[model samples]
Target chain A: MSNLIKLNGHTASVAEDEWLLVSLPASEAEERKQAGKVVLFKLTGENTVTNKQIANTVIPTTGKVIVPLSVFIARKAVLQARISKGEIGVWLSTHEVLEHLIKSQPDLNGLPMMAIHVERFADGRIFSLGTLLRTRYGYQNELRAFGDVLRDQLYFLKRSGFTSFQIRADRSAEDALASLNDFSVPYQGAVDEPQPVFQRYNRAV
Target chain B: MYKYDEIDQTIVDERVAQYRDQTRRFLAGELTEDEFRPLRLQNGLYIQRYAPMLRIAVPYGMLSSKQLHKLGDIASKYDKGYGHFSTRQNLQLNWPTVEDSPDILAELATVEMHAIQTSGNCIRNITTDQFAGVAPDEIIDPRAIAEILRQWSTFHPEFALLPRKFKIAVSGTKHDRAVVQAHDIGMEFYTDAQGKMAIRVWVGGGLGRTPILGSVIREHLEWQHALTYCEAIIRVYNLHGRRDNIYKARVKILVKALGIDEFKKQVEAEWAHLKGAPNTITETELTRVSQHFETMPYETLPRHDAGFDTTLVSNPAFAAWVKRCVHPHKMAGYRAVTLSLKPHGKAPGDASSKQMWAVADLAEQYSFAELRVSHEQNLILADVKLADLFALWEKARANGLATPNIGLLTDIICCPGGDFCSLANAKSIPIAEAIQMQFDNLDYLHDIGDIEINISGCMNGCGHHSVGHIGILGVDKDSSEWYQVSIGGKQGNDASLGTVIGPSFAAEEMPRVIQKLIDVYIAERMPEEHFIDTVRRLGIAPFKANVYTKEGAAA
Candidate 1:
């Protein structure tokens, strides 16, 4: 039971007291195998890995099994049971994975900080993702957005629930800081204020 | 006329300040162009072909004399000393600079107006009958509800970035003067069994590349649930509407794809969560909004006026103008007069700065300081005294606002086509001009009687060609502009899209095509039949055969 278990041409082992991260590769699954006490999996592209295959390979052991957030959300019930049993963790790469997970699982709270890449800000997904993570899912972990973050979008990002932002190399933090107060009044619900403008009006009046 | 309360005033002022800051940031290079485009559009500033066009909202088509003067001042100061009243009942300044937009908005705010939500993928300016409160057939005034919707949708957060623009039209009568069936959301106000006002809701009606008449989703919805029901409909469209194709993004496509019953089911399911929400209108709030549009005080007088009767017979032009332009008002001793903006040789709905000032003065003198912009691209003095018809006609005639061709063949509704619009496929104004010149004889026009000749530069249908009795759409064929003629479309209560007559014709041949259609009408019409009636009586066969004939084609 303590030795490496080989199933369907994939190899993985359970550590005694540490978490394991697994990386599922298409053709070189044997070459990229980690022999460390903690193993985490980074599944990329269309692979043949199923929820049952990952579960069978990782379960019946004591160590923590970390998987990609997208796979975790897709197999939430099976992974959530493992997470509650202190045998699983999630690794996230994009905001969409977190948004879907939080929206589908309301009881999910306190996600571990994950690397967030902000590729486009004009589509308003960055703001909405942050809003859903904080307001709807009760996410308490630090949320970060990186890549081409402008000073103007910072105002919306912070209000929507971003704790930290990786500004571009050329932009200054002071310029970004000044934009947080761009609009004194916002018309929507956000992490900091959960009431819409109309409800706020009713309360004030 | 709904006056702005303190809250409304504060909201407009705050929006001005907010936009001023946004403009400053963009000018200083802090905000990128992509990030600033939607914000600027929400403020009604569009980067057109030649210059920036700023559209100002005229809520439910109502304007005060003071507001009109403010518009005139802005037009003269910032634009090319003129403005165009659009078919959506808004005003567009065709030649304003982007930098001066904030100042223009500030000027508008002073007169209880702003450019909020005039353009963008948001709920646009709410439209209603130009004769909302004064029409004899009206059950209740729709302006109160239109005003409420205006406030409710302003800067609505969830609906700000919809897949496409949304439009709402309210009608208080069965006549459908506001073209309610052609809007994104059409509300028909009526009295229920308990004598309380209720609304019949219609959804997904729009005219774009696809022309669809809306279907009734709810037969009788209580009046208080208007806002919440609208919210449910919008949220469903915003979240599920197509974002892949720009042309297929309107709610009409969504409704069509899901089918009306399934769409209504989804909307009702969503409404289940928002029905009793705080946004629901209360009696107090209803009364508060309704008080703003209460009937004005009028002097006690007989229904008939001898002075009005004498003026009608004394001058033939005045008699013709009264017959065509004057509309019956619900109130005794009062009438609604449409000041025609469709004078010959001029672009329809384009008002010069001097004409704006003149109309403002006329409204102040004869219509209790109120005026309206009709969806027909004309202006209305809704509360004019019957005895003041002759005096008002003289003033309107001198200012080029009296064409006496309302509801007639030459009262054309045309879009600012390839000349100013970047999206036009061909030129529409010149086509309208040619047709008006060809039918310049008022006697000939009056003999033809009550024909709506709507022209659009493209299939966007800004001129509402789909509902025009004689619809002319400009198409680009082989890089040359060609006109496609359609006939027999009727608007009012029996709204129907026009049928294309035949193959396309050259721009120079539009007048001949229209003449041939009118000649067919004259030849085939029954006694006392209108143009549309004749076209409906005999199908498009006669007209199509006559227009494509060798002699008709060579004319």
Candidate 2:
């Protein structure tokens, strides 16, 4: 679990994150897909690893787990039983192909959690990706923005359909929480405020 | 002027508070310089070579008398007693402290002005023709739409951190006075086949290290789709514009790399989802905005005033001012007049607080209490009555605002280059001054007829050197300052980048080299042919040959 997560605009210590995200074993996943074999990824009660950097994966009999969307799609049969109970969540990186993911199988709509990765602080691709997922595709779940995220961007991150923020290490979660209300009014249309200023009030008057 | 309503007021007021806190954190050492740089830049505060330079937004060049007065107060109170009007329609205070910026922005908010999103990678101030509303040839008043664009771009969250700065210019008339062809996005208003107003959009135009004219992407887009379609374009660029190289980060590079056709395809695909969505412009909103730009109170006057005719015949200076400075208006009795910031021997666009106050008074007395900051680095009284021309001319002369060199060579557009900006390769202001001193003769300047001389400090083209008929670029030659001259660059509907003539010149030699170029045009030009027309008739070869002759080249 991460140190802190600002969930629903309330900053709290991350005592536990229901499911831990597991990165795909790239070469093995590709090889197993080529061989038409299912690869089961295990969620271990890890040590000596940051919550996001867990590496051990085989089958240690799973607890709740979140895998990359591709990993879950390849092993759908094994993951299907847990997904119905909202135990297996799917995660996607900002680097993933958006056009492919929007129309991906295993429907992101039913997931209990979908986390979008901000690989770099300046990479704004995830903002649009987050917007489309909530506004166009109508993804309604715990939408978390993690990895390389900071306090300065949390205000708009919340506006762009992000419900929870995993502020990057050692910085303030309370400060990030306060930054959410920096602007009491925003001019544009976003997930949080679907009605733009024009529709909300006769501004030009 | 578009006055701020409650929402507009709240946004700026909130912006002030937010910036105040950010400044406090920064000064307390909570925020590092790297982290605080972009935040400060977004508020139009740049840490220049000498001090913090704050650029105050003068939305599309329109300013009321009250706003002008407030700016004067701000200049004198927070900075040195002077400010410079930029090539883009904004004012730059060159001597403000980083600590005093918050108080400056707060003062601006009182006058319904703000510095939000004026700099940094976000969308910059939307510029149009300075004579937007009053131009006789205008098909539409671009201000209303420019205002809409301003609000849409201001504080836009997703776009606040773009790969590079983006600028947009709108032209409502056939003439491209706004220099639309040199911006990131240029829009022209026209009527479509359906008899509704539409926009002709140009993409990939910019003038930094690469000076490229915009290519037309969409020929006929309904005006209602402007904002949403713009969102689609910027969003695509935001996601796909190359971030690896700082030089290649502008939307122009992305548009060029993708090709206009491929880029248009992507933008159209994105716009399909956003078109007619919540961000679409509404008729009610447009109408409400348009009301703010409606015609000012004008009395019924004849096409020609007899008394004004007498004054013109007697006072040749006033007539010369009218010929070069006064512009035709849509209204019968009104004419738009240009107040030359380029007085004969002064720094091109520098105006003291005294001049600002004087202009504000003139704007109230003779021009309906409104003034416009022309992109050519001058002021405009857009609604001066014909009968008041003589009185206004006399007063403007007294205030150092009346120089009859509007379209002539002396009216140079220059950047605050090495003198102030951190990125400038060499000083630009001295080069402009040297040229101004050489051509100090008003008789020779007016005799030469309409020509534009634009100078840039570096390759940034902040002074729009690329589009000037005679462009001057300050370049560094082994830690020494040298200048490169180009010929035939033009702005307007037929905008073209100038071609560099030959080798660079020493600082003092710039004026003499320019003289050589002008001598060639004078010798070769046909009767009444302007410098640009002469250049087009003959190419850069003739001008290059004139400057690089044996003894001339040695000098």
Top model by TM-score, which number? Answer: 2
lDDT of each: 0.79, 0.84
- Candidate 1 chain B weakest ten by summed lDDT: B237-246
The sequence of per-residue lDDT tens digits that candidate 1 reaches over residues A48-131 is 345545444433345556555556666667666566665655544332344355565555543344334554443344554565
Q: Write candidate 1's Cα lDDT for B138-224 as tens digits.
A: 997989889878877776655656778899999989688988889899999999999989999999999767888999999999998
lDDT of 2 by residue, B1-555 (tens): 898998889999998998998899899987778778888998999999999999999989899999999999999999899999998889999999999999999999999999987888889999999888888889878899999899888877667678789999999897878878788899999777777889999988999789999999899888888888888899888877766566777989988888999999999998988999888888998899999998888888889999999989998888889899999998898899999999866788989999999999999999889999988899999998898998888899998999999998899999999999999999998888888889988889888889999999899889888888999998999998888899899999998989999889998888989898899988998999999999999999988987888773554
Docking class of 1: incorrect
DockQ of 2: 0.29
Best by DockQ: 2
TM-score of chain B of each: 0.98, 0.99
Q: All predictions: root-mean-square deviation over Cα?
A: 9.2, 5.8
Using Cα atoms, each model's DockQ against the true complex is 0.07, 0.29
